[model samples]
Target: MSTSVALAAALAGFALGFSMIVAIGAQNTFVLRQGIRREHVLAVVAICALSDVVLISLSIAGTGFVLGALPWLMTVVRVAGALFLGGYGVLAARRALRREADALSVSGAEPDAASRRRSLLAAIGTCLAVTWLNPHVYLDIAIVGSLANSHGDARWLFGAGIAAASVLWFTTLGFGARMLAPVFARPLAWRILDALIAVLMLTLAVLVLLPLFTGSGS
Candidate 1:
């Protein structure tokens, strides 16, 4: 690929990845919590970053064609994803409403090592589900990847650029946000964060389900 083309592809991929990920959602909330607790932060970030890598790789490799061919399958995934998001949103809202100050504190400051380990595992699992189980992620990566591949540039180079962008974006989001852990450690701050997350998750779920109920977007 021409240097100009490669540069353009990289910039485009970076913009797309950052735009999609830099939002309040389950994955971001979990990462933020882990960062505040200062437990297994790197592992959580790694899991989030690697999940994006695998998904983006599949998208670039043309596996997204399967999603295009199986329309019914995507519908099922969409419904499941919506339900998951809604349930998570409710939980977040409940936490905010309950206002359990102690529960919101940074877990495992000293003697609660076992609790910290479990929390780390739970965070990793949640991040994986939030990243992998959402049908929209597949649509974004695959549909976008397919279109980029069709643009007559070197396919491999374009795919590489996109994948690199994913890595960069997630790494920054997961780790860079650690700097704000002290601020979020405050109970009021967590309450606000959880409330915002609830709103974002519910909004996304409604957006996903509206098309299904109306049958207008299909």
Candidate 2:
């Protein structure tokens, strides 16, 4: 591939990856909440971006397609993912009830009964779950993997570009969230955000489960 062709392929990969991930979804919502809370921001970002890195790389190498042949794998993921997402949604709804919970949630402050401690490790684990458990994630890998493979020998360049997009987008989302801190500083904003997160997670869980019930989109 000529230099121009390589760069073009990389840019195509970057645009495709960025566009796919920029949409509103459970993972994005969780990232936004972590960013606003200023809790475990780096870990959240790292987990999300790194998960995408693995998925994208698998896609580029064409391993992602092989996973699609196993319907049982998706079935297992669907059940587990629904349970996790439903539980998280319940927790978020509980947090929403405690309107007094501080947005900043400073340490040593009187803790609200409905509020749970948000630890870095917990955040990392949650991000990992949200990224990995979703059946939609594999579909993204399968789709993008084909796109990258289309670049033929230049697929490495394409993969690198997709990885770069993941890094840049998540970094901006996790860090750029601070810019909205002033707005989210209010307790009501926190409640609204948590409520939205709850709904988003729950809805995604239902969508994942719907396939099992209706046998569509599997």
Q: Which candidate is the best by TM-score?
A: 2
State in Å the error of residue 185, model 2. Answer: 2.0
Looking at model 2, residue 207 earns an lDDT score of 85
TM-score for each of the candidates: 0.84, 0.90
CA lDDT of each candidate? 0.73, 0.83
> lDDT, candidate 2, residue 47?
88
Estimate candidate 2's alpha-carbon lDDT, on a 0 to 1 scale.
0.83
For every candidate in turn, the CA RMSD to the true structure comes to 2.7, 3.3
lDDT of 2 by residue, 46-122 (tens): 88998988888888887766877876777887888899899999998999988465666545675454443446557
Candidate that would win on lDDT: 2
C-alpha lDDT (0 to 100) for residue 206 of candidate 2: 90
Poorest stretch of ten by lDDT in candidate 2: 110-119
